[model samples]
Target: MGGLRRAALVLVLPAALLLSGCVATPQEGITNSSSPSELIPAPASGAPTTSAPLETAQTSNKAPVYWIGRSNDNAFLYREFRDVPDQDNPVTRALRVMMSQTPLDPDFFTPWQNPKKLATSISGENVITVDVSADAFNSNVDAAMAERAIQQLVYTATAAAASAGLIDSGQQVQVVILVDGHTDYVAFNHVRLGAPTSRSAGLVAPVWIIDPQEGDSVGDGSVKISGRSTAQGGKLHWEILKVDADNAKTAYLNGTTTASTNAVQPGLFTLSANLGPGRYEVRVSQVDASDSAKELFQDTRGFTVK
Candidate 1:
């Protein structure tokens, strides 16, 4: 919630409305299952056809699917990934995963209707166009909720497209929303929906924990920490904290890493930390390279080791 405070102030619903437990339409394809393995079948074509290798698609084509979650006493959108099938339209499949209402983590949720409800496509120059159903805007929510809902779609679509290589990382992908195939439409009767929206970390969780996800238990001596960031020069700082009943304390494992050598695209970093059996919190932060004190973004997740 570091860099998101101002945006939240502008977009957050009234405290009473926020506390009223306004749940958005459940994601479309999610089920009460353990892994994405249960969500959908592999592509029918059954062959690797993209520029990316088939073996990589079969095993490593994991794409991020963004959803809403809570941390640091605030509600912000976060990301998780699913193994995308190796097919002609991997980007579309990834978008389907994002549009699906099911969250990999029980703690996450989304306010947007399923992407399947809208006809989604990637056009020239990495522009994603979503033709939304008129019925998709029937939510009785406030302006803040409506705004977040649109952002939910924008972030998810662009993220999915980037993961599938349809769009470049660190580059802004434009998302155009159409209602009943018309660009001029109102969303949720509150927010206008005619312009192209771009992905911004200020609108979504800028930091994410890519491994040892919430409620996970690791037997290995060390936990691998990794995630995507939009910070300057792709530089990131991290800290490991141990949580006890009375207080949460920082552990000795703390350091910094670069997500990328240049900051043109989303930067990724991985670190390994050793810990004994305990409950711990891992925090990732984006700081100004010139002034470390000027923290731009932060995110944290809890996990257990045994």
Candidate 2:
């Protein structure tokens, strides 16, 4: 993103939310409040257009929603494909669920409170406009977490738009958040809103388990596990741990495998193991460069085999 400069709201809707009367100023030394709307600058010259209906845009019944989760003792975004209501606008549907529903994985959660009203629309410039009620910004957080929370919306909105084919994948996608159609509101008492936000680099988990989502069940015998990593498809260490009735874990399997560097999604890896009926955990990690024996950016999933 380029240096901070004021951006004019080019598109205007007939009915918009009332502007917030409260005013907030960013505290000095807080870099998170800086604006980066240029990352998804408005197109040179194009009238903003709304997204097509679900019948024309949606590729599947599922919408991808990103949630905030802890990994390696730090917060990062994790995604899950959730079923969407038929005929509903995919982008707004996903955003509503993201703010209101509990994540399938216990480790993932959203700081947002469900707004009274929510809506989304895409522009010819590839910017997604998310007009959510002011109630959604009720959660209190620090500057760093607040920044991440806003990015959480950025990631979810863009993802939803992409999954529904509302925007072109080849072009950069950004999200412009408006509370009830008004801008310049402070979010969570930290980050300011109304800026065209893009996904902040390095805010996603380096490694995340995509299958057997936390607390899943599978059939006995051969079980397949897979995940995505950003380690440049380098060697990854994997292990399976069997949990006994006493809830103690016993090492079941361990090995080293390389993620597919050429995968369309990048760093995609898969492995399978044979096991009798039991509860088990699959963990994957890369060796810490400074300490080969220590694991770095580890991600794990628990599942039961019937």
Candidate 3:
């Protein structure tokens, strides 16, 4: 590969995990379904909450939920922060929503069924125990899709934990899944449960729309589209398409943007547009090196300009 393409790959993909340095172990008997639920160690009871109280409390109720979506003809995970009702159990509530609730993005979907019961607890070692009923595996999936589904759970669980401050984000976090308190059970008849699983590599969308999420409304007609994408040769393509009453789409604007190759937030890119009141779709894609006119990987989101 050439130097530019190589750099693009490094910026686009997540850093590889160095598991050799990790020495944490899962606590035995804590995997039982009846184990008391404790979302990691919190401040001792009756601590002062006056410092940034409103921001802290509001964040406590928000959970980062991951959903499976198609991109580049394959399945990958996408994320959205949802306001869950159960503030005390962010991880568990996020898992329940992942299995039972529909994703806010229409392009995303979940194959897991609503389990009769779901629970989560994080150990001091950063290992999350998720004990769920067997009914969650009701949906059938092939080996490949099933693996993504399991990762869908892994990503959601880990994100929730990190967001809720249940685990230190700097440390390596893993998830141990259990179906009805049993280990080594095959999930969706494909992937085996019970082992500590970390977020899998290459499961994230190469290009995604972060701001103005699907179905969002831009009240002032000033829209800002931002996302992360692999910039082949430092170039990415974006376009805004207007949707007509009959569902026909007409290209309204298009341009090329450069992705950041810096150490912080590599592949991050953003653009802005002003439009009249109407529905529109914003698309971001990486140009195919082999074919200039073709797109290698693309992501899109639909919203309204009110």
Candidate 4:
């Protein structure tokens, strides 16, 4: 995640219409380009390995939005969203970081085929529309999962927006899904929409990679926890909490324990502060600077170190 990652081709799906933010336009059916001259980022951004930082802005007293698709990104949301003057929303920042992380690869794409990446933007409305590139469809994601992936993005952004506490209660934080500037189920081959073509949850392999799931058992050992939380025993990071009473009281736990690293997975975490005979509490919270505690998605299992 430190270095730049490689780029991929687009994944076009004729069967699955608008993935999420992509709305169906009257003319093209789906698109992020509101104008003909809009310059959509080549999804490559060159090749980003880590998560991309999202642009945050102060709340605006504007009307609610119904769609956040290609047209929306190019027309309304591009420059409108900004960071709060001096405030720092860690949650929002974390969302931005998660975005730049390794982008999803294309599905069912051929070696010779060139796929396009989908880029989205949000402005006037809370919606972030995406122009499903041919590359995305070609990525070979599951017909059913494609829509889910798109929807998850919408949910993530909305969660961030809600945390920012911007906009009004009248205007709901919503994210519309779109595909290739249109909102119709089609394949990379440009076939008409039909029955659910998605074989299962997705066309691409759903990965739950934990960079360092297991670490050294000895306290002197280099304990580095990682791997996909979605995987079995994936949430091994929070199993043990070291507590050293002699150490800083403000610290969360004892010994040298790694903090929870939310690497684009879903889950929660709790701490164990039961200082025993020789054990002492060091750090109190899971948020630490070592693992860059921004936003970690992990399964939460409460435990107290006996």
Candidate with top TM-score is 2
- lDDT scores in order: 0.57, 0.70, 0.67, 0.29
18-61 in candidate 3: lDDT tens per residue? 22333334443323211212121111111211110001112446
Pairing residues by index, what is the TM-score of model 4? 0.31
Tens-digit lDDT string for candidate 1 (121-236): 66545556666677666557755556656766677667655544455454556676767666446677655654566653344554566676776788858678777654324567
Please identify which of the two predictions, 1 or 3, would achieve the higher lDDT against the true structure.
Answer: 3
Clashing pairs in 3: none
| Among all candidates shown, the one with the greatest lDDT | 2
Query: If scored against the real structure, what TM-score would every candidate get?
Result: 0.59, 0.79, 0.78, 0.31
lDDT-superior candidate, 2 or 3 = 2
lDDT of 3: 0.67
Residues 8-123, model 4: lDDT tens digits = 11233431333433444444332222111222222111221122122234344221111111221121111112232222232233233333332121111111123244443443
Model 2 error, position 150 (Å)? 0.9
**What digit string (tens of lDDT, one per residue) describes model 2 on residues 1-306?**
011000212343332222234344556634333352213211111212111111124546777888888866678778888887754466787888899999988878889999998977766677778888999988877676777788878888887777666677777776768877777767887677765666765677666778888788899988999886666546678999999889899999999776665635556679999988989988888655455687766787889999
